[model samples]
Target: MSTHALGSAKLVLAQNVVHIDPAPAVFEAMKEGWARQQSARFLRAASITPRLRLIERFGEFTGQYPWQWTPAEGEAFIAHLRGGAKPIQMSTARTYEVTIGLFIEYLMDSRYGWTEVCGERFGEGPQAVFHEGNSVLHTIEYEGDPRRRPLDYDEVQALFDAADARPAKIRGQGRKGVLAALRDAAVLKTIYAYGTRRTESSRVDLVDFRRNRKAPRFGNYGSLMVRFGKASKGAPAKRRTVLTVPEMDWVVGVLQEWLSEIRPHFAPGRHPALWVTERVGRLSPRSINEAFVNARQAAGLDEDLDLHCLRHSYITHLTEFGYPARFVQEQVGHSHASTTAIYMGVSNEYRNKLLEASMKARLGEDWE
Candidate 1:
């Protein structure tokens, strides 16, 4: 059995170790305890794997029962992490913190007699000691930034035009290449227009298109609900957004055609995931990134542009069009209004307008 350790905590794996079973008690406990405690859907998804591995590694490292470690031992572990072995990315390191905190809380509750070797926050207890011990360690500092960006109307149109005009492979060796390019370009458009994350966009099935079948009228509206495996347990509610008519039309026309015709020819799968690779699996985030990179090069656009940038661009577009920040936040499923405000900054046109107004006010009617 494979196992690994982080700091004082250890993960133990056993041959045929049925770790998480669907027992009623286990299911109910996890529902009320582990999953319910986590706020973000994504965070819950990440906790399960690391904790299971931790259990496996414990036995492997010490050749003893899994739950054995002193507070000092735990602190030493943190130092080890900070030192070199696990120089994890900030995003990934945060998951480790969340997992450890939840595991400790579970142990303390007495619902399960899981032993506790340490108290206080993981970062403060063992992790801090290690951090302080290492003078050369680089601390992570948060510079607040918003998460979504979408391209402007003109830029998106230009990119589409560029993709359409990409030189054919020696003038007709294969239309498959041309069609694939067209399909990917449309995929890019759908993601930006719909404000979907890459995973959500990738797993989107052909059935998702039928959600538009009964299109909503003036007094009626339709929602596109994205469902997936929840990190925590229970009925996973859909993260849904309503679509405007124009948005619906673009998705229905361009995106639907790719699914109906092109995607099946290139990539086939059990579920009709909207995007696919030549290999027949749903496109991964890496694939989406590579596609974006190639598209940018072909379009002669700035190299800095990527998939998520389109999300930010969308927020900016709405802000400039005079939509209220609150409305924009809701449209993009932003939990915090401030998060939306960060990406959708005051546009240059708006800033200049403010300056002009200030000048006019200062100089009376003399300043034009």
Candidate 2:
């Protein structure tokens, strides 16, 4: 028997395996055993804790223990989730399937002895109900809202202008939020400049900025250290160094002004966070989102466009500016080139230009 089936002394699979008699108690033990297995594999609490909740919820829905779960129950549960006043996103539904699938995996692995244990106690064991036949397929590259796209160059300019205008209006009204207004503007711009997610933007620290030797003109603002890039399954936060490009050189001034002139006003002594609240704490992702929403509204941009569009805009603009797909992928901390491609919503002008260039190079001629 594999050690995975025979969980550690601290885990119920080993200690209280036989003692647990009631179905409810055994179900709890299964969760505890699974958590132990996840931790043993170096998974974080954030990953393991959620799985427990998901398992418990699934058990509640099926009105059965892990040993009693079947493919039918899992399918029914997912079907029920597929329809509602506010249905789950495709990504979300897929995540539910993956989670349940993994939980079932844990219980059926013969090495874990759960199959044997369940067969002896409950006369059955869990099986993966979310197999390819019943699960959501990963067909589309982008499963997000169709309306969400990269802001055009003009829209980006308008967004920054709107954000910049807020501080002036606040000062004119004798309001106290001028500093915060400036901060929010800077936050929004930085998110665009660095291709940062809201969480990545909020998690940035002052010390994270690095001077790229290749680009001395930008100084310490040349590269940004993203310590909280999105994590893959059962992984820690991904980290990457995003180097500044000439196309986004304008951001250097913005960062300098915020660091030297504006952020100091917050008096964030000993607080390392690049973006701080008035309380000297790191700003939350929600605050970063609100900053984008206010800027979007002020710019009179499309309602479907959200904070993520800024990141999309960054990826798209970089591609248009002739940056290599690999470079863009690295800058944005994406694991795969395909994932980066999903963000590239190139303009029609860019396509026409590319076609003209291709004709010139290949045919050595141009059409009228």
Candidate 3:
């Protein structure tokens, strides 16, 4: 029969293949085969390992090998996941179902000969256990937590104010967190000003800053190369340059003060990271998140607001400021204008101004 290097048929014939517990041998081979197949497609280990673990979890829950699996077991396992104290989100449940479906499809493909191998050893062959009827439907494009919306203009300023006050507040209480607090304040303002994701905020280097010839006053802080922009699945991080706009140009001073004065206290020698921790050259995404939480609590903003809301706020404010949709999309590095539009939560006042401007164009300036 047809066989590939990591195919079940080829693996079963190996000298080092498991000799006892033939069922377990075939099962392990199937997983290894699937992992190798995914590797060939250029997926990283971080992207592939969770699928293997989920398959193992499913196998354990069903108490059956691939050849012995049925739709009932797959449905039952998903149902079990939806129950218990730690029930998963619908998005997570859908992902699990999809992973199971992919794993089953891989095993049953004739070229791999897994079906033939399983039939010879276990008297059965793998079959599709998941289908449209049992799978979770993902109708919502934005399935993120509903609470994570954009901060209002005032809330954004208040958050910045709180982060700024943290250094003095800690120093007043006689602590050594003054420098770290200042760094975090700068980091938070930068995130809102640039509309960056958490990792993008932490991953920037000092050299990423660039000057704008047209806006020479900003002086080497006019824009930044976001080297760690969000990526497509299995792809490298995308890069984009976010320009300094007039509205949020205050971020220029914040960054200038941070790089020159406060950050040196951290003694980050030879470290290129824009945001650094005491022990590590680069700050972590989690620490960025914690900074947002502490600032939000200090500001007494809503508890539901998280770090991502800064990006949301940036998108919203840019829309209210009359930036073209396409320009905003490029600034934020969204591949689609539709994705950019979704993040924009323009104010009703802006809508009224648009209506008035349209009327004035047709009805004349004296019409009002």
Tens-digit per-residue lDDT, 1-368, candidate 1:
42321111222112233435323233233333444334323444455555656533432443423234333543444445556865545444444444444555554454332233223112112122112342333354333222333466677777766655653541366545665566677777777666666777776766554344556532222445555411224234346554544434555566556766777777475756767777777778777766677777877876666777776777777676667777788777766787776666456777797788899999977897
Model 2 poorest ten-residue lDDT run: 1-10
- Give lDDT: candidate 1, residue 12: 18
Q: In model 1, which runs have C-alpha deviations exceeding 4 angstroms?
A: 1-47, 54-91, 116-162, 165-176, 206-237, 245-253, 256-286, 297-305, 354-368
lDDT per residue as tens, model 3, 242-292 = 999999889989998888898887888888888888775698899999999
Best by lDDT: 3
Give the distance in Å from residue 58's predicted Cα in candidate 3 to where it truly belongs: 1.6
Candidate 2 lDDT over 178-267, as tens digits, reads 888999999988889989999999999989999999999998898999999999876789999999999889899999999999889899
Which pairs clash inside model 3?
Answer: none
Please give the range of 10 consecutive residues that has the lowest summed lDDT in model 1. 121-130
RMSD of each: 9.3, 2.6, 2.3
Cα-based lDDT for every prediction: 0.54, 0.86, 0.88
lDDT, candidate 3, at 122: 78
* C-alpha lDDT of candidate 1 relative to the true structure: 0.54
TM-score between model 2 and native: 0.91
